[model samples]
Target: MIKGLFETHINVSNYEKSSSFYEKLLNIIPLYEDRVRKSKFYWVGKPGESMLGIRENYPSPLVQRQHFAFRVDVEDIIHANDYLKALGIESTNFYGDSPEELMVFPFMPAVSIYFDDPDGHSIELIAMLNDEPRTELEIMSWKDWNQLHTK
Candidate 1:
């Protein structure tokens, strides 16, 4: 039977630089490293949660960037935007514009903001705004989501 996500591997040009970036971003240290394999990765969150593996990209560089997301509290979504800004990293919307415009997935009733990692990987922080069950996919603005919930 299928359980849940155990780990996800990401390719980076430099191990030290990528590791440092992830350390600050996730606020966790690598649980394991294989020096012989030239790979170092981190196990983030709590036990049985998920692992983020940062492997060195040797020989060939990434031809294109990848996008991935992390789920956080709605308030943390806002806080993360400010946090990235404080670190001089600019946050953006799905269009890669100002993050002040929060994107909403009404199907999941989630809000999200986006930014890039040191290796140019698009990272997203998403927060579910409602506990109400949804059966259909819906897309709307965060403003609409707030108003709907407040009303």
Candidate 2:
């Protein structure tokens, strides 16, 4: 049976630029690179863990965009927003709302913020607010989430 996600591949126009972006975003250098491939590629993150592979696009043109999320500390989500802002990056809510807004799923008790990469890929930083098990999925505004938490 399959265990878990090992790695994910993202196609990019330039390996160098994409690798550099990941290096800064992940705060870690690539773990491996293969110059032998027709289209250059590099791997980031630790071995056995969920890693990311960025590959240089060949003759194929990028037709569709992609979206992915990273699980982060509850507190870090806020800090990450500020960090991205400092880097001149803007974030948005799940609904593509204000940059200052955060999205909350009441059932999951999770909060999240989203931003786009240079290639226009949607990236998200999400944090779980509670340890309770989720029985259903529910989306709500930040205001509603906060109100529920305050009760």
- TM-score of each candidate? 0.85, 0.80
Model 1 accuracy (lDDT, Cα): 0.75
- Which regions of candidate 1 are displaced past 4 Å? 133-138
Evaluated at residue 55, the lDDT of candidate 2 is 68
Error of 1 at 25 (Å): 0.8
Highest lDDT among the candidates is held by which one?
1
In the range 37-122, model 1's lDDT, one tens digit per residue, is: 66787766774587788777753666258787776788788677789887777888767767887878767667898888788988
Model 2 accuracy (lDDT, Cα): 0.70
lDDT (CA) per prediction = 0.75, 0.70
lDDT of 2 at 130: 73
lDDT of 1 at 108: 66
